[model samples]
Target: MSTKLALLPYAAPARYSRDERLRITRLAGALRLALNIHPGNGLVMVLGHGGEKNNLEALETWVQRSLEAQALPPNRASLQPLLAQLETYLTHWEADK
Candidate 1:
């Protein structure tokens, strides 16, 4: 039998200021564009590996370090929340394996 995954609902917290929400949205768009431009990036590979916990951990660590090194963009402070959102989004697909 085939199982269908339900779509995850996402609503930004009310505590986030309007500017913060806009920043998150912009960051998300940029990420989507980058992923589209480079289909074989590590993040895509990790997600395609069926949501293994270790893969997620490795990706998170790499991303955190990259952010700290200012290799990504914006700033670590701005990107942290987006990273959390990405984690939650990916975690929702864990059952697809």
Candidate 2:
């Protein structure tokens, strides 16, 4: 018998749901360690290739909302600025639409 590991597609989108919220938290934590971004220092924001602000905002909202709903503890000192950014993005999203 041979054991094998299949790498998930990098471009695959995360499915949003209650269960997935836990997954996202883990994903963020892994990213923090992998990118060397300590919560105390700063948060990492990865802009996708050819990504526009609108699309970015939408993605941000998806992640932020899940975090808030789950009351996920901040790995950093604070998450206020990140929350504020998402709020601002939503405001403009409605105005632009």
Candidate 3:
């Protein structure tokens, strides 16, 4: 005779925590950044309505803080591209000024 083991149903991974969500919301608010969570596209859109250099810097700082504080939840890899785009935009914007 053999012993039998039970199997459990698998569940989807958590994409974000409540605390992290709130933190992201607050940061976006403070930076005047608009966020669009598109489930269809699976993207957290950060629409920046142009601001001063310091404001962009602040956004970058906040993002870094989120990573450091372990506030980045699932699909966190997406943030890297966003940050890179932000930096590039800021650089060109500054250059144009």
Q: Which candidate leads in lDDT?
A: 1
CA lDDT, candidate 2, residue 5: 28
In angstroms, the error of model 2 at 1 is 53
How high is the CA lDDT of each candidate model?
0.44, 0.41, 0.41
Query: Model 1 Cα displacement at 37 (Å)?
Result: 8.5
Candidate 1 clashes between residue pairs 3 or more apart in a chain or in different chains: none
- Clash number for model 3? 0
| lDDT of each residue in 1-97, candidate 2, tens digit only | 3323221123434455765555555544543444344344212223222342443333443444445545554333224444454455444544544
Candidate 1 structure lDDT: 0.44
Model 1 segments more than 4 A misplaced: 1-14, 37-97
The true-structure Cα RMSD of candidate 1 reads: 12.3
lDDT of 1 by residue, 3-88 (tens): 45443232222344566445544554454554342333545444323242444333433343334344354433556555655555
* Candidate 2 residue runs with Cα over 4 Å from true position: 1-15, 44-97
TM-score result, candidate 1: 0.31
| lDDT digits (tens) for residues 39-93 of candidate 3 | 2311122222123244443453445444444545423464655455445544454
- Each prediction's RMSD to truth: 12.3, 15.5, 17.3
Residue 94 deviation, candidate 1, in Å? 10
Supply candidate 3's per-residue lDDT for 30.
Answer: 38
